[model samples]
Target: MSHDAAMSVQHPQDIDQGHVVARYVSNERRYLKLLGGGFLRLGEAERAAFIAALRADALQVSPEEIGALLGYEWRSRLTAAWLVGVARRIEWRERVGELLLASELTYAGQGYCFALAQFGGKNDAEILVSYLDRYLPHLECRYDQGLALGALLRLDSRLGTSHAERFAVRDGLWERWVDALPHTRGTADAWADASRSRIDAWCNLWDA
Candidate 1:
């Protein structure tokens, strides 16, 4: 399927019982779908409206629908994670943590990190620390290490923990991540600095 067609896939009614059958592409799922791309391209006013709608829509999604979204392809999974985070659906926290550790898909980890950071609890920090433990040793895997670390630090500040310090020490996991970056970006702290910005952007999405 074309990229556009794939983005607009029909979400079957089987995925969302109780809700009337209709084209998901034309409904609130579109906001969930836009979490993948179109949402970021809007002007500031439109973006604000879009973000509001997404949060509102998230409140209306059933647990069954969230489970189905998480089980779908990357885009839907990303959307589900974002919705879970925005809605502060604490019940799904562990499930999101499991997906983060699994690293099953490409872009979905970004959403998982966002959700965990939004949860802002010790459990979320522990999950990120575990992820770093598993992946930082494998430098070549170059996955969501930066985002995960940044989210950990964000949680650390909020929850009064220092989970990220060991990783940022000289020649440590942070350095390993930086080394894996492209040759043009070789500064020791470049990755760490960039990570903060990325996590901040995700966290600040709903801020005043």
Candidate 2:
């Protein structure tokens, strides 16, 4: 899916009840996508509203709802992961870690990475390491290695750990991964940019 595609706001009545994000109001769903950074065309006022709405909605989302969202398809799972980060739901760390390691769906791992980065603990660091450990070897996979590495690097900065050191060395996994990309930007730039947007979106929710 094109991340830059313009997403229309759905009305509460227009949204299907079976949709993973349908539990949230239409505006919340729209803002959630904004938070996801897949839709970048928003005014400042809408951005502020997205942050506030996400903050309020995260608190209201239940454990069961979150679990179900994670169990659902990529969009729901993505939203669930973002909510986990915004709410700082540490209890869901293991589950999100499992999903991150699984690398089940496209784009969803970005959310998982963001959640782990928000949790920002040794275990989360280990999970990111495990992800890099698993996927970095298979250059053909081309999954979330960049996002995982970026998140791990961010966590290492906060935790003062060298977890990302081996992967990021000269002509190391990081270099290999970047070179393997078909449409990669500068080294680590794509990962750093996307990860920053994801973290900043949820962090702003908390800051609000």
Please report, in order, the local distance difference test score of every candidate based on alpha carbons: 0.74, 0.71
The digit string of per-residue lDDT tens for model 2 on 70-150 reads 776677778788788878899999999887777767787878888898888999999999888888878767777767877
The Cα RMSD of model 2 versus the native structure comes to 6.5
Per-model TM-score versus the true fold: 0.82, 0.79
Q: Please state every model's RMSD to the true fold in angstroms.
A: 5.5, 6.5
Candidate 2 residues lying further than 4 Å off, grouped into runs, are 1-20, 25-36, 39-41, 182-208
Tell me how far the alpha carbon of residue 191 in candidate 2 is from the true structure, in angstroms, after superposition: 5.6
- Per-residue lDDT tens digits for candidate 1, residues 76-138, read 667778878878898999888877787877777888998899888898999999999988888
Candidate 1 regions exceeding 4 Å error are: 1-41, 181-185
Most accurate candidate by TM-score:
1
Error of 2 at 28 (Å): 5.3
Candidate 1, backbone clash total = 0
